[model samples]
Structure formats: C-alpha cells, structure tokens
Target: MSRRNPSRNGKRSTLKDEGMQGDPHAISSSFSSIAVSPRTPKAAHRMGLDDETEDVELRLLGEDERQQAANGLDVEEQSGHSTHSLSNEDKRAMVLLCVLYLIQGVPLGLALGSIPFILREHLSYSQLATFALSGYPYSLKLLWSPIVDSVFFVSIGRRKSWIIPMQIIVGTIMLYLSLNVQVLMDDPSNHVTQLTFLFTSLVFFSATQDIAVDGWALTLLSPESLSYASTCQTIGLNTGFFASFTVFLAFNSEAFATKWGVPHLTLSAYLKFWFVMSYAVSFWLLFFKKEKKEPLSDVDMSIKAVYKTIWTICKLRHVQLLVIMHLFAKVGFAANEAATSLKMVEKGFLREDLAIAVLIDFPFQITGGWLAANWSRGDYPLRPWLFAFWPRIGFAIIATLIVYWFPKPPITMGFFVFLIIHTVVSSFTSTVQFVGISAFHTRISDPLIGGTYMTLLNTFTNLGGTWPKYFVLKGVDMFTVASCKLQDGGSELVVKATECVSDHGKAACAEIGGDCITETDGYYMVSGLCMAFGVAFLVLYIMPTARKLQGLPISAWRVKMSDS
Candidate 1:
C-alpha cells in the first residue's frame, strides 16, 4: 500500500505478511485511519492496524484474484510504457510500398509528359501549346486534395481502407489511359478524344492514394522509422516518374506509329499485359489488416474542426508568402513548359528522339536529386539562399527566351542546354523548396493532421503553377491576332537602294536581302522577353525568401560561397 499508494507517512508497506496485495488505486493509511479511527486499531496488522487489516489482505481469494491483480498490474505497466515501435516486417512492407509508388511514377510521367511529342507527330497540334499540357495535373492537384482527404470508403483495417483499393484503381486507370491514346488521336478536336479528363481523374485518385500510403506509414511506424520510409518513398517516386516517362517512351512512341494500326492499339496491348500483374499485389494488401490506425492524427480530429484549424493556419504571414512565391514561380514555368515542345520540334527532334533524350537525362536528374538531398542537409544563410534561388531561374528563362530568336529549330544546342539546365535548376529549386517544406513540417508537428496541411501546401503550390500556365496561354491567344498578320518567311529585295530600308531605321516588307526581319520574328522575340522577365521575377522573390529562411539580416550584402 505504501509503495503503490505512496502514503504521506513516508513508510513502506511490506507485502510479505500480506499474501494478496492491495489495489494500486487503494487509499492511503491516513485515509484508512480517518475511516476506521484509533478505537479500531490493532497492532497485529503489518502497519500496526490489527486483525481487520490482515483479514482484508488474506484469502477467501484464490488463484483467480491473484491472476486478476497481476493482470491489472501488467495493464498498468503496459499503459505506462507503451510507445511507438516497428517490427522487421514493417520495414519490409514500407520498402515494398516505396517500390510500388516509385514504379507507378514511371508510367505516369511517360503518359503525361510525352503528350507534346504525341500531339506534334500525330495531331499537328502546336508543339508549344501541347508542351504546356504535360505538367498540368501536378500543378493543379491541390485543388481537389481536400475532397480526397475528406472521404474514405475503407474506414477500417490497416491496408484495406485506402491503400489497396487506390492502387487497384490507379493501376486500372493507367491501363485505361494506355488503351485510349489512339482513341484520343482518332479525333483530335473531340473533347474526350484523348481521355484527358480520364487521365486527370486518375492523377487525382493516384495523388490521394499516395497521401494515404504516406499517412499509413507515418501513423503506424515509430519516429525512427519515419526518415527511412520518407527517403525510400521520395527516391522511389522520383525514380518511378523517370521510368514511366523516359524509359517507357519507346512503347509510347510505338503506340502512335502508323504501322501499329488504330491510333493507340500498341499501347493498349501493352497495358493489358501490365495490369494483369496487379492481381498478385493482393497478397501485400491481405495482411495489412494487422496494421492499425487510430484517428487521423497525433493531433486534431473531426473533419470540420480540422478544416477550421487549417483555415486558421492559412492566416500566418510566412505561409501566405510561401504560397504566393510558389504560385508565381510556376507561372513562368507553365509558359516555358508550353513552349518547350515547340522549341524542340523546331530544333528538329521527333517524338522518339525527345523520349530518348528524356530517358538519357534521367540518370543526370537522379544524380541531381541525390546531390540535392545531401546539400539541403545543413544550415544555410538567408542572403546566400535567396541569392541562389534567382540566378539559375533567370538563366533558364533568359536562355529559353533567347532560343526563340534562333533561325533554325536549334535542336542539338537547345537539348544540351536544356538537359544541363534542367539538372541544375531542378536540383537547386527542389532542395530549397524541400527546406521550406521541412520547416513547415516542423512547425506543424501533428502526424495525423499532416496530410491535410501537406495537401494544403500542395494545393497552393499547384495554384501557383496552374494559374500562371492559364495566364500565359490566355495571353498567347489574346496576343496572337496582333502577333500574326506577318508571313513566316520574308520578301527578298535587292536593297540596292540604300534608303529602301528607311522605315523607322528598320527594313520594311520590301523583299530586300530577305525581308531583313524574316529570319526571326518580333512576336516570338516578345514572347521570349516575357519569359525572361518571369525568370527574373522568380530570382528576385525566391532569393529573398531563401535569405529570410537562413536568418541573415537584410542589411548584410554578403554572398557566401560556402553555401553554394
């Protein structure tokens, strides 16, 4: 009693004389004294309380009570000591999950990214406009993530609720996308022709599934397990994206070949074979029942309440700024993405070559990813970080815009520049973005509510990228009328008259040594300049954001190479 109850008298209760122990929750001796009084006391009790105390401790109680008491103690001990832990099986399952997710990226990237090439070869769509479509979903996924977060058909069990079903659906959709490419090409003008909507639906579904997979792992595993799981998933997801898009391009290209008969018949055949293997994945899901989840988080419950909490978080200044930066940063990106394929086609690359080059570029990107992963590990100053963010983006925008001025498609030169630039910019930006995200993650420490916040961040990020793309496209369409009214090639005049070119110090439509301006048009140059300005904007805003993160004062104009 003294040990379990810790009486105020500072005395220990000996269990030897008492065959059965008192309940841990039992009252102290002083309380017992208050209950019984001095008149009732007897020295025979171990605590000098007499026979009554002894009687209470002794035995009409058989093995059952003793067992129950022991069980009670065990329960207490367990409740007291319980903590997050993971078995070896958990590690293995996580690895497998990462692999599946990563692999899923491969096909998805191929399907979405190769569209510009596909449009160019088969449908005669503008390469620039088609290219913009490639990165559409990722930049827009945030818009629907909340809906994805809110509902669940499989509410119980470890793997059954969301993970297994989502995988099955994604696989099915991927197969469908594969099968429908030809259907898309059959009538390019048809809204449903290429199954773009279907493809988008799959992207949304897959992103949700990804979140669930992440939540499942985050909730079930110990903190120690979190890092490895996250890394595996990240690395794998990137790898999968590479494989699906780059590695699988040959098949994608073959699907569009005239010899393949029916627009996408070849791809459909391949998808049928690929999706069949998904059946074996059931075994992985079967045992997921053993894994358990509580409510959605270490913090926050009730969907409405969580939404309200998120609303509150949205008011934070830094968060708002980050969202703005993320959004604006991508407006330029959208413009560039839309224009890149056109640039490629003009440079003389076919769909097959584009695919091949992308495949070849994957290793370099992976290297970039690795280096980024490593480089983002340490402390950095805000000024340098801010400085670092802008220059590369500036270069990219400028380089791309300048390329618009080229006389020919400039394929080989542009590809080499793009491949190298992609590697560097991707690495630098990804590393910085992840740092900001990591900071955000730290501020919001609840594991359960993480999905919602992450989704929110992703949504803002998507809005950032998507809105810009639309703006650029709209601007292009709006300006095209004014942009046109000029011929692709110019009139060729002898310009034997020195003053034949006296129109505002510029040559007129007179066919002199070529309309003098036919080699590169002013409209394309304007578009290029706009892109360059956007790049400059990215550098200016992001560089400051980086500096703010590094905690360097604004007055300090120092550039630290140690960071770079």
Candidate 2:
C-alpha cells in the first residue's frame, strides 16, 4: 500500500515492502520519514499511548524534527511561567470585554447603589425592599441563560445577536427612564412601585447582555489570557459602578456640589448621559466588533440539548455542593453589605461623603482584584476565597460598630478618615473574594457551554447576596421598635410608631408635635444575626467543601457526554 508522506506532502511512500514490518530499524526509519510533528506528552497520553510507545515515537523522529520538538517544548515551558504576557489580539479582546462589562455595570450601579441611597430618605425599609427586587433579574438570569447560549442568529454571530439587541433595549429603557425617573423619585411614596418596575426591566436586559458577553469572553481571548477575564470583569464593572454610584452621587448631592463648588447633576441628566453612552457603545459593538463563529462540536447546540446539559451539569455532586456554597455564602455579609451604608445615611451621613469613601475604596478594589487573579491562578484557586472569608465577616462586624457609633451629621475629619480606612479595607477584602471565586469559575467553566455554565454559577453567587438583602431590609423594619413623642396640652405622651403604619396615621403623629425615637434599632440586631450565620456557615460548610471543590480535576467540572 502507498501512503502520502506527512513530512513531504506530495511524496508517495510504500509501507508494504517485504520485511519492513519485521525490521524494527526499517520501521522506525520509515515512520520518521513520514512523521510531521511530535505530539505533546499530554496529547500522547490522551491518545492512550504509554510511556514506551511515546519513547518509540520520539526515537522515530528525524534529527531536525527532534530539534523542532525540543524548541516547541521550550516555548511551552517558558509560556507556563509567563502567563501575564498577552499578544496584541489578547489586549484588544480584554479592552472589548471590559467595555462590555462596564456598560452592564452602569444601569446596575444606578439601580442598586445610587437609587437606593437617594430613595432611603423618602421611602421606608419595606418600600426599599420593593426596589431591591430590581436586582433579582441578574440573580435569576440563569433560568434564561441556556436559551441565550443555545439560540441565536448564527449569521449575526451567537454573542452579538443577543448583545446588540439587548444593549439597544437597554438604551431605550434608559432614555425612557431619564424622562420619568426624577418625577417618580420626587414622590417616591406614591410611585415606588412604578420606579421598581422600570428599573427591574432595565436590569433584566442588562442581565441578558451579561450572558452573551460572558460566552463571548471565553472565545475572545487565547487560553492563556483566560485568567484575566475575571480581572477585566472586576475592573470594568467597578469602574462603571464607580461612575454611576460614586461620581453621580457626589455630583447629585446638593450639599456636596455646594461644598466642592461643582455643578450639580440631577438624576434625569445623569440617566440621559448614560442613555447616550449606552447607545454609542452598542452601535460600536454592532458595527465594529465581529464575533468569531464557534466550530461545530459533538455536543448538541440546540435549546433542549443546552438545557439538558445544564441539568446534567447540575446533577454532578460537585456542582450541587458549589451551588449550595454560592447560595448561602453571602448570608453573613447580607445586612452589613445591604443596609449599613443606607443606615448611615439615615443616621445623617451625607450621601456625598459616602460617595467619597467608595471613591477612595475603588482603587483598592481594582488592586485587590488584580492580586486575587494572581493568587487564584494556581491549582488551589479557592485558597484566596477561603482566606478572605473570616476577614470579610470581621469587616462586617467592624462596619456594624462604626454604624452604631457614627456621630450626627457634619462628621469630623477624624471620623471621616476612619470611615474611609474601614471602607477601603472592607471593600478590598470583598473584591478579593469576588475575583477569587470568579477566577475559579472561569477555570472550571466548560467553554462549549460557556454562557450557560458561567451564568448558572454567577446566578447563584448573585442570588446568595440578592436573596438575603430583601429579607435583611425587611428584618430591620420588623425588628425595629420605635415611638413618637407627643406633647398634648401640658402632658407628654409617647405613641408607638408601629401603630402608625399608614400615611394618614404617620401624618397625624407628626401633626401632633411628635418626634420619632428609636427605642430599639433593628440594624444592630439584624447585623449581629447575619454575622453569626456567616461564621457558622464558614466553619461548618465552606472551608471543607471549598477545599474539595478546588482539589477536583478539571474533568470533573466538565460535561461528560457520550460519544454516540
């Protein structure tokens, strides 16, 4: 039989010469002449070649081929140590990913960070709980993520098909909101429901965009650059969040604007600005960015198959444990993360001052994320996540103390400095934990179902934080015991605030020269309980499970599809 020589593409080689099979030297020489390139040891092993077979294969290679193989091995060895190095293409992909993530963060920042603080004064804790619902779309995105992954316009590109449309919808919603958000906030008591529904829709579109971008991210950069995906996400989201929350809050605060002698910004103007920015970015992506089509694979890409894959992945014991970990991991920090800042605002802390603290904390957050990416790049990616757990809970405790001891408005410079230090330290640790977990997720995520897999994991992480927040907010109001002090004629009477649940009742209490007094602040109690849960959960569940999960082989995290 005649075979084409791989080394000399057009040359015909005879493999059936008499005695060729019996003569080992002749066979090796013949194989060497036909060989193209050497397989990596890993590839050889995966092909079921034993060490003896690999040695034989190596010995069969021609001298020049052997030298080429040696050089390839050297390059790979050097690359192992230089993962930080990125090609120009990688850098561009990183920039593109960061921009996309940053765009997602803008609306999220305004809804979750800025609006909550703005409405805290006008709305009660219960009403704020409704606004908190807007955050759920993100946490619940996993439900629809499979559809995003499985269904798309192949011509428009899998990721771009969703990203383009979602961003356009986001821009439209922002434009609509820019026209009405201020009016809604002006009478928050009467319009809280409408405001909640509006922002919820905005957040929903943003979450859908996140799923597509996440999938695209897996393919956008080279495998070596994959570790930076989480870092880009952290930096980008935080920057957008910084702009919408810290910058916007600082400018929107009349007190801050006057104090700094800067032009004041209104919510309407801010929303309008983001609307324009969103549209601009969306258009840039639609026209300039071209998504590379994914190659066909054995695994089905249909919607049913994608969802079945999700189910199969969920059925894995390790995944179930990880999901459980994601669901309850944030319980300890819930009250502190969700309520502490708003409580401080209620305690007379200026919104602008709070903004300043976040502004200072921002750099550390980015730095921490970068550091975490390095720490998580190793085999034990969850190490940093576990290490930061206790420190985060401790920070929560410290935050509680700070909130309790917070002095009245016009905070002293010393106190402000203390708050900033606390904010920076706490935020740094939190960022580390977030990035560490995210890096691990990126490490384990199956690229074939990148969108659904990443979204499923991220959904649980977000839910862990999101689900607890609403309860914590409600718990604060539920646990709080307050009274109104009223002077009737020459006698002073105290009426329970709980009895004044309605607007008319509250108005009546205020009309009778009543002053609200908190006999028992729920913030302290709720924070204490959250901390306790966090500590117990860490000691009992997280540490042990995390170690096991991190120790698992990459194959364990991947889908085990049949060859058939």
Candidate 3:
C-alpha cells in the first residue's frame, strides 16, 4: 500500500489508543492517513542524550534516557542544572486544557439535538423518519470506529497529529457555518436560505466533532481509568447538552428579532453563534498531550476483521442478553425523547413548558446518575437490580397508569410529573446496566477482543430501535387498521388492539395522525412494562448474582455464558 507523505502529514506520534468516546469519526479517519514508521533514530547512538525536545517529543525516549530515568540518574545533578523549565503554576495549565477540551461537547450536542427539531418544521417526514434522524447516526458511528482508529492528519506525533487537526477542521467548519447562516437561532421559516442547508451542515460538523472528540479523548487516558474517564465523558456531554437545550436553544422572548439584535435572528443563527463560540475550545485542546496505550494500523485494518467482531458478539450468550436488553431500553427510552417536543407543541404548550420539563427532569436525571455511580463501589449497587427488575415492572406500572389510572387532560402537569419519575428510574437503571455490561466485557473477555465484543451487543440494540414499525405507531394505528379490516370481526380486532395500546377508556390517539399516537399516560404505561419485562429476564435468568443484593428473585434474569 502507498504511504501518506510524512512531510505533508508531519512526523507521526508513536503513542496508540485504547477505545473511542461518543462518535468514531476520528477513529475512522485514523487508519486512512499517511504515517511515518516508528524507528530508532541514529542520533540516540551517536550523541549521549538530548533533553531539549523532551517536553514535547519525549515520547520516543532513547534507551539511555529511559534507563537513566528508570535508574534514577539525575541529569539535573550531573549538569548542575535542570534541563526542564516551568514551575508549579505552569502545571496548573493542565486544568485549563482539560476544561477547554471538555467544553467542545456543548455546542456540538446542541447543534446535534437542535438540527432535527428546527429542521423538522421545514421538512415533512413521517414520525419514524424524524425519530430515526435523531438517534440512528449515533449507533452507526461504531461501524466507522476502526477507520477513525487508523487515519491521521499529521505524523507530528499523536497529540499534534490526527486529533489536533481534526479539531481545527471542526472549528473552521463551524466558523464558516456561523458566518454564512443569517437566522440560525430563530425558527426554520425565518431562515434566509433553505433551512436544510443550515441543518445539514450543522449535523455534519456536530457529528464530525463528536467522532474527533471521542477519538482524541480515548487516546489520552489509560485503560485502568476508563470507568472514571467514562463518567467524566458522560458529564461533559450531558452538561453540554443541558446548556445548549436550556440556554442557547430555548428562545424565550416574544420574537427572535426582539431578543437577538438581528431582525430575523433564526434558530440557525443562534446555533451558528453558539458553534462559533464553543468550537473555540478545540483550538485550546490542540496543545495538550497524554500517552495512549494501543493504536491500530494498516496491518490489522480489514472489513472482515471488523465484521468478525460483530459475528463474535452475536454468538456469545451473555453478549446476546446485553444486546437484547439494550435494544429494548433504547426502544423504550428514545420514544420519550423523540416525542417530547411534539407533545409540547400539540398541547399548545409553550417552548417554555418544554424548557421547564428539561429543567425539572435534568435534576432528577442527575440524581439518577449519582445512584448509578454508587454501584461502582459495591457488589450490588444498581446495575444488577437495573438489569434485573426495573424495566418490565416500570413498563407494567406505566401501562396501568396510561390505560386505567391517569390518562386524560391537564396535559402539561401530568406529562411533566410522569417523565420526571420515569426518566429518573430509567437513568439509574440504565447507568448500572451500561457500566455493568462494560465491566463484564472488559474484565471477563480478552483484551484483544474487548472493544469489539462490547460494541457488538450495542449494535444489536441499535438495529432494534433503528428499524421502523409497519403499522401506525402502536396507539394510533389500532383504530385505523381496525376500520380497514373487512374480515369477520377483523375491524373489531383493530379496535381491541387500539384499546389495548391506549389507556382503558381515553381517546389518547391523535385525530390527524396514524395509529401509534402516544399520549403521556399510554407511553409511560407501555414503556415501563416493556422495560420491566426485560429487567425481569435479566434478573431471573441472565444474572444469578442479581438477587443477593436486592430483594428480587434469583430466577428472574435470562441465563448467560458467564452465569454458567
């Protein structure tokens, strides 16, 4: 294979990587770039030692330097001076880099969640298409991970190589987007050009930044600290998401022209402005360097090898259980995120109401996160119970509420209360399960195969939610299909199915939409039940260790290879 030019790419870094973060773009791009082969330099043998370049390029230490450092040879003492420069205050600069680097997630996430919501008003897609747009690309990023693993923008060593340039690229694109888009912060119709241009570009940059950020961060930490790193990663991401949703995306004034100086300040404009400001974090991130553990190269890059991981995940019993449960989790949880804004719009709820929902639920979500973190320290914190009992039981409770207990008017209060409780439970449950699943694969499986093994179950879950249902959404289609059936009592079957999907007597289905119209009560009820059942299987058959911690039954989860 032809090699990429070293001069054009820069001298390559020798440090490798451990895993990916949110998106895999950087990972996907890694292999495709030109690299300088790592080799021993002649200078190391000829000259005794050089300390000048040690601060930046010290990664490829000469044998003598390594031996000296390991042997506690004080070059500082021998030279009667320290070759190193800088003081304690200078070391504090590291915190600034972390803060700035970690800041990239906000604008990126806002742009991501914002694009679909703003653009949806402009383009007409089925409910399924809209839902798919928001969550689908996230899952597919795994397919691109290996590629991001291999490519590099510079050979200038690792930190200055692919990651630094990609961030610069992302910042540049975001700057361009901000410069061109006139009314990005306002609603779609106020846009100067077609809204699709703004949305499509925003999505691209956001996704691009995601891949790059995840790759860069993944390469910076050791495997032993991944759990802590992952927590930090999640916090950074969620914080960014919260800021974008509440502060930037939530337009509160009477009109865009009034609140923003521009006469027609659009949602696109606001988002572009945020991107311009937020992406500056990338430029700051360009300076820091931390050593990586493992790196992928051309020798191992192959379609078969990538697919082989997927096949392996499918064959394992424990892997299969994780995959199935994760899918249902998304299917249950995503429906809420997908439907929330639309729900707000329909009930004549103001954008502020949606904002309120986010605020109220966010704290609850945080509480749940803390609960999840608690599990990391103990034998039965939350993961075992989460995967064990919550999902299906939550499904059953929410189902009953929708069908019989509370499925009517007073829409805003009812919806908010339900979600606050629902999301809190889901968050805690998911956190435990997510981390638990990772621990199982990371600890029990071969290190060589760990990343692939973890992602395979993730893929199975993605495929479950990504595919659309043929019938109208569960609640709405029942009646419409019931009306269409001409067979003996086929029409009645649809009615019964519709009734089955909805709260017992409530007309929760949307008048204008197809069957799967979801109301607050109906959604809560169905999703809770589904989640509960999945949890039950996990507790009874999959994980025997689950009940010892909680009062749950020992025989509830699905059996796995590890269990046996």
Candidate whose lDDT is highest = 2
The TM-scores of all predictions, comma-separated, are: 0.63, 0.83, 0.57
Give, for candidate 2, the lowest lDDT window spanning 10 residues.
Answer: 20-29
**lDDT tens digits, residues 1-564, model 3?**
222221201211322112222221101111110111122122211221124222313332344544443234233124312134434433343343234334445544544455544444432223324333433444565675444444554434433354455455555656665665545534333442444343344444444445444444433433222233344445555666666564444553244336555354354465466555554654454444433333333333344554544554455433454555545544433434344344334334445444555556555554554544444332243354355345634543453344344334446575667755664565445444454433333222222323343344445544444443211134322222222111334332222323312222133333422243333333444344445554555556545533222222111111111100
Model 1 misplaced regions, further than 4 Å? 1-87, 103-107, 122-159, 177-180, 191-194, 254-265, 277-279, 287-289, 295-300, 378-388, 398-402, 405-448, 473-541, 549-564
| Residue 533 miss distance in model 1 (angstroms) | 4.4
Q: Report the C-alpha displacement of residue 98, candidate 3, in angstroms.
A: 5.9
Total clashes in model 1, counting residue pairs 3 or more apart in sequence or in different chains = 27
Better of 1 and 3 by lDDT: 1
What TM-score, to 2 decimals, does candidate 3 have?
Answer: 0.57
Please estimate how well model 2 matches the true structure, expressed as its whole-model Cα lDDT: 0.70
lDDT of each: 0.44, 0.70, 0.40
Arranged by lDDT with the best first, the candidates are 2, 1, 3
